[model samples]
Target chain A: MTDTENTPKQTALYDKHLEAGGKMVDFAGWEMPIHYGSQLEEHHQVRTDAGMFDVSHMVVVDFTGEDVKSFLRHLIANDVAKLKEPGKALYSCMLNEDGCVIDDLIVYYLSDIHYRMVINAATRDKDLAWITKQVENFSVDIAERDDLAMIAVQGPNARAKALGLLDAETAEKVDALKPFYAYPMGETFYARTGYTGEDGFEIMVPNEEAAELWDALKAAGIEPIGLGARDTLRLEAGMNLYGTDMDETTSPLISGLGWTVAWQPEDRDFIGRTALAKEKAAEKTQKFVGLVLEGRGVLRGHQKVITDNGSEGEITSGTFSPTLKKAVAMARVPVDIGDTCTVEIRGKQLKANVVKPMFVRNGKSLLEA
Target chain B: MSNIPDDLKYTKSHEWVRDNGNGTVTVGITDHAQELLGDIVFVELPEIDTEYGADDATGVLESVKAASDMYAPLTGEVTEVNEALDDAPETVNTDPYGEGWIFTMKLDSMEDLGELLTPEAYTEEAEA
Candidate 1:
């Protein structure tokens, strides 16, 4: 789901999804498809072939002005001033004064005075408010790209399928884009990044072109994936869903996203830096870990985790990995906990071993490490 | 959508009871129940030989979306539970009325079968 179902928001591709027998659900604030028929089959399609996802529910905001980079340096926890080259992107979390996560976003440096940010739609209101408040004194203007729609073409053959739909010039430029890189050719912007833990491109184009582009990609043999497979794919990839894995009350340090934080350039002042430094010094109680159930039963969120070291935690995100053929979950446990824990499933305690994440990537299990 | 065999009795809660005519009954969830649940992920059926009341929670059925309790349709002593669910719970999604049958029980009170819904009534109620 991309938008909250209680609301009336719908993505540009909503009709197409429904036409294809998609099961609609409320995500963020929009009605989005969870799947077409079998979520597991869609999950397998992405791992083995190519799949396209409607990610237009995400908010794309463009910042233009002389002080755009300077404004972002104060708005995000990462050092965006370090992004020297155009078309380079950095992943960072915007934190509040209390050092809690406000939202995780991707910032792309388009030029010295232009930047583009893609943020979760669920936090659009608050994110806009926060950015507006910070840019008051800076020479920058923030504009939301409501006219744009995003589509993620993922899996092993995703690039080939996407390239087949683009013009020769754009295809050549897109072909040269490296991971964490983006390039704009005409009205379409293509980024060589995805959330599926697979190689792919995230294409952003005008709303009118979205449906046509999706149709072209489908014609090129890309499967139309829905939110159900998206969830399982990201879970298997060890990627965190914003609200489920972390929220306004949780810090990124304990949310299995510490690596995304850039701690260098102590002189660089970003939002929540002081509090994060203090928390870093004090050391937190929570630690995120991956759990694989050794016995029967599927693990799910809110399930109690009893560690061998007398520590307790709860599963934040759990699902049956289509790629792994077993139940896997991400849990936030006490920092002192050992490598093994027991999950309480239907009154029976099941043993689960803890490990680092990235359970599956590129159709291969990373759990062996 | 699946056909509820005229010979089987159903509970409003969606469990189907098939009479074995030997003071015993086979039990499983209705096809409509499985369709609403999408994909069956896990099932926790009662152990064999367990004594249960007519309305007792005999087991649990978990899907990718939610978890539901399977209620006993009649007072009985459990004789067997479907072990195939341990490997492939999706059998319930594929064949809810036949191969996905949950358990069998020896009826302690045969009169309880009269309180169960007939195939006709179950269909109308499910549709409504």
Candidate 2:
């Protein structure tokens, strides 16, 4: 039986996840929890209260030794020079030479000659290989830290409760940490960042300490979240998910990630800059837009979108938003598309309104286009 | 453990067919089916008066995980659909057997009922 099917990988907290009534599913080859019970409840829990997620499957890589800044400056679409302080984190999409997204990651400036990057779980092998190959003669050393585990505590009251599990000083430090910042207190790395569009922290702890922290969080009333809620929460927040929303063949410009590209300091060239410039000069036809289904049926990934002008597009990520109480999606449509379009679900066409990609932030609706 | 009612007939594809004792039969997903799909978000029912064959996909049930086909258990024409599911898909997850009935079909023939699996046989196949 084992030979007939490929077994999914388990993370450090796999047993804890199963113990909490988590329904396991194969996600990108990892045996991850889809939900403990209701996905909608978990989604609401994160928005209204506090919840924790075992996101340990994502890979963490560190760069050390001389000229690391220069190496990163040329590697990612966003400028590493933007990171000025220790533990400052910046989100960027690493692109290939043809201007397609290789992977979207957060790079943390640990110090002058050292930095850390966290990438998606599914793209680990290729992301590492790409970074390794590009570091040929640079004086930097690459270290993939598989020894650490990542846990995200998110929601309105998540930070205050997460502090209850840590030391007082650490709690104070966490309280002071600004959004989009990362700090190391003892062996734990706490970053005030999350994909859920809520006030929260993504904490990285040693593998041995992960389960204990999770148990403590659970004991303190922080709910254990699964990947099922994670997808809906991120979709409601209008965050882009890798592999689904954008892939190696899709450019960041058309994937709702054009804002992440830093075009200033025109002389500082990065990979795919020329291709992106050429695409920009030619006026890229496709653009990213948020779609809210105005009629029946669920709008799902790959559903055909028809603009008012008869142009065609496709939904990259779509879900039923629990907060907005409607079906919403992120789609790549023609630049000429108006504020509303039609989506073909099953055999019928349903009207949808096109808006900005972000639909919610900080537990409130950011519906303004 | 998933519930398998002894009185209802089941399809290998996870739908349940109940004999209404009249000329028609009521169709819905089983308890086991709803658990697998998780929190359902949308249900697209077949049009009234639409016809379908045994095991034909006539509608869709969508959850956060994916969209699955709601197959017709036997050859029949749809007489009524679960209109409540248009706004409340969670009925399928909360009450898969009762309120979540997908559609009712007027049978083409009493002979088509024999194609369905017995509850005992269905449990074995589903478990296996």
Judged by lDDT, which candidate is best? Answer: 2
DockQ of 1: 0.52
Best by DockQ: 2
Give the range of the ten consecutive residues with the poorest summed lDDT in model 2 chain B. B57-66
Q: Score the docking of each candidate (DockQ).
A: 0.52, 0.79
TM-score of each model's B chain?
0.95, 0.96
Each prediction's TM-score versus the true structure: 0.95, 0.97
Docking class of 1: medium
Regions of candidate 1 where Cα sits further than 4 Å from its true position: A1-7, B1-5
- C-alpha lDDT values of all predictions: 0.88, 0.90
Candidate 2 backbone collisions, by pair? none
Cα lDDT of model 2 by residue, A135-182, tens digit: 897889989888999999999999989888778888888889999999
Best candidate, TM-score-wise? 2
